[model samples]
Target: MSKVRKVTDKILEAVSIFILGIMTVLVVYQVVTRYVFNSPSSWSEAVVTYGFIWLAMFCGAYVFGKRDHMAMTFILDKFKGKAKVAVEMINEFLILLFAVGVLLVGGYFGALKQMTQADSILPISMGVIYIAIPAAGICMLIYFICNEWDLVQRLKGMKEKEKEEE
Candidate 1:
């Protein structure tokens, strides 16, 4: 599980970096073309917009996998032992449900609906941009499964330690 998580982390990191780099270059090009050449590059602008969407979605999933997403942990900080593990598990389950119901299912339908629509500047279907939603959802699901497994292992270890202490 850890190996799988590590590979996924590297892959997502690489993709996010690549997208950022491309977007940066495109933005620079857009600025140069507009200011230096006195003409704006419409295609670059469209590409950068789509790239930013992909970057944001992928990076969000990556952050979730790293367990680095923002949260108000004041309530969580009060839990102890098995209760803490249980609460964490429940929280993860809720997030997993949201990823499935909203990001996966809803995103799929949204992308499908956009498939028939073409972007004004880009030569591709609008679905191409929306597809990132479901892709990130899939990444989130994988990370959730890995997280749940880790929590179960931790809970079992805690139980074993308690028995030893007794």
Candidate 2:
């Protein structure tokens, strides 16, 4: 599982970096063409917009996998021992439900609905941009499962330790 996570992390990181790099270059090109050549490239602007969307989705998933997403942890901090682990498990379960129901299922269908709509400047369907939603949802699901497994293991260990102390 760790090996798989490591590979996923690396892939997401690389892809995010690549997208950012391309977006940066495209933005610069757009500015140069507008100011220097006196003609703005509509295609570059469209590409940059789509690239930003993809970059944001991928980066969000990467943050989820790293457990780095912002949260109000004050309530969570009040929990202790196995109770905390249980609460954490419940939290992860809720996240799993959201990822599956909202992101995976809903996003997939949404993308399908957009398949017939084409972008004004780009020579591609809007579905291509919507795909990032489901893709990131899949990544989130995987990370949620991994987190739940770890929480369960921690709960079991805590129980064993309590028995030993008694």
Candidate 3:
């Protein structure tokens, strides 16, 4: 189980990096070709745009896995007892709910796009581009669940400590 967690995180990290790399390469290549070569491939813009979309999704999931989402921790820090725990659980539940929505709606819509091909430069199925949305959502959901479980364990341990002290 521990090994699987490490592998899953590393996979997410690597995918984010891969998407970033592709985005950089595509953007740089497009700029160089358009400016330096005096001619641009018509496909460059679409490819770069799609690459950016994928990068954004992958990086979003990766950051979520890291528990680095921007939040005002100060107020949360003051929380205690059931209120603190309940609030925290609600926060996590909302995020989980969003992820589930993404997985359901995004996945279904993405499948629909897969059947429709883009009419523009790339001329590929829209599915290729939109699939990332649902995929990232699922990834975020998995990470969030793992995070909640870890937190529960810690909270249980704390409770144990409190009882022992009493």
Candidate 4:
């Protein structure tokens, strides 16, 4: 079980890192060619732009996994017992729903639109750019699920403790 979880985490981390690395390399290569070689290919700009879309989405998912997704702790710290649990669950569920909606509806339509369009500079299909939305949404959903499960267990434990005190 531990091994499986580790593998999953590594996969998510690697993919996020790889997307960011590609973006950096592409931009750097483009700059070098335009300035040093004195002739930059038009395709380089398109590749860099598309790579950035993937990088930003993946980075958002990475933030969720790390539990560093800009949360407000003061409000949560003030609540105790079932109230806290409910608030936490609701927050997680809302996030999960949003990710699922984007992954399913927005992603589907976006991919369709992309496939139909002709990219101005690159001969590559636009589907490549739109696919990142769904891919990152899935990753964000996975992180939400994992984090929600852990929170639910803690909430249950807190309830049990409060009952014992009463």
Candidate 5:
């Protein structure tokens, strides 16, 4: 599991870096064209905007994968043993629910609804851009599942130790 996660993390990191690099280049080009040449590229701005949107979505998923998202840990810090594990499990479950319900389902429908709508500047359908939502949702869901699996394994180990002690 850890091996798979490591590989997945590396892949996501590379993709995130690639997207950021591209976005930077595109923005620079847009600026040079608009200010220096005095002939703004319409497609550049649209592409940058869409790229940013996708990058943001992927970054969010990456953050979740790293388990580095903001959290109010003061109260949680006081917990120990099973209590701490329980709290963490609950937190993971809530995140799972959100990713599956809000992100996956909602994002899919949102993109589907936009399938017929075309971007004003770009030739692609709006759905193309909106697809990022569900893709990120899947990424988040996968990370959450991995976390849950780890927690479950810990719980089983604890149970086994308890039985041995008894």
Candidate 6:
């Protein structure tokens, strides 16, 4: 399971890096065309905008997998032992629910609705752009499941250590 997670993690990391690289190149190209060439490329601007959307969505998912998300853990910090594990599990479940309900379902509909529409500057269907939402949701769901599994294992290990000590 962890090996699968590691492989997915590496893939996501590579994708994140690739997206950032594309964004950087596009912005640079836009800057060069606008200033140096004295002709702004509208297509480049649109592509950059869309690229940023993809980058943000993908990176958001990638970071979630990396467990680099922000949290207000003040109350959670107070819990210890089984209570801590329970609180963490609940937190993960809530996140999983949000990922499914909001990102997966809502995003799928949102993207489908945009299928007929095209961006002003770009010729591609807007649905292609909006698809990132659900993709990110799927990524998040995978991470949450893995996290829950890890937490359960930790709880088991803690219980085993407790038994050993006694």
* TM per prediction: 0.98, 0.95, 0.86, 0.84, 0.91, 0.96
List runs of model 3 lying over 4 Å from the truth.
1-4
- Model 3, 15-130: lDDT tens per residue? 76787777678788888899999888668778778878877877777777777889877877899865676677778888888887866476758668685777467778888778
In model 5, which regions exceed 4 Å deviation?
157-166
Please provide, for model 6 over 1-166, each residue's C-alpha lDDT reduced to its tens digit, 9 standing for 90 to 100.
6876787788788987887888789899999999999999899888878888988888888787777889899999999998999998999899889889998999999999999998888889999999999998998888888888999999999999999999
- How close to the true structure is residue 103 of candidate 1, measured as C-alpha lDDT? 92
Q: Compared with the true structure, what per-residue lDDT tens digits does model 1 show for residues 11-43?
A: 999999999999999999999999999999999
Clashing residue pairs in candidate 2 (N, C-alpha, C atoms within 3 angstroms) = none
> Per-residue alpha-carbon lDDT of model 2 for 42-111, expressed as tens digits?
9999999999999998898899888899978898899999888888888888888888899899989999
| Evaluation by TM-score, superior candidate among 2 and 6 | 6
Better candidate by TM-score, 1 or 3: 1
Q: Single out the weakest 10-residue window by summed lDDT for candidate 4.
A: 1-10
lDDT of 5 by residue, 2-78 (tens): 77667668878998899889989989998999999999988988898899999888889888888999999998899
The ten-residue window of minimal lDDT in model 3 covers 1-10
lDDT of 4 by residue, 64-136 (tens): 7667789987988888777887788888888778888977568867988889787888886788778888887
- C-alpha lDDT (0 to 100) for residue 67 of candidate 1: 91
Residue 155 local lDDT, model 4: 81
Model 1 misplacement above 4 A: none
- Candidate 5 lands at a TM-score of 0.91
Best by lDDT: 1
Error of 2 at 122 (Å): 0.7
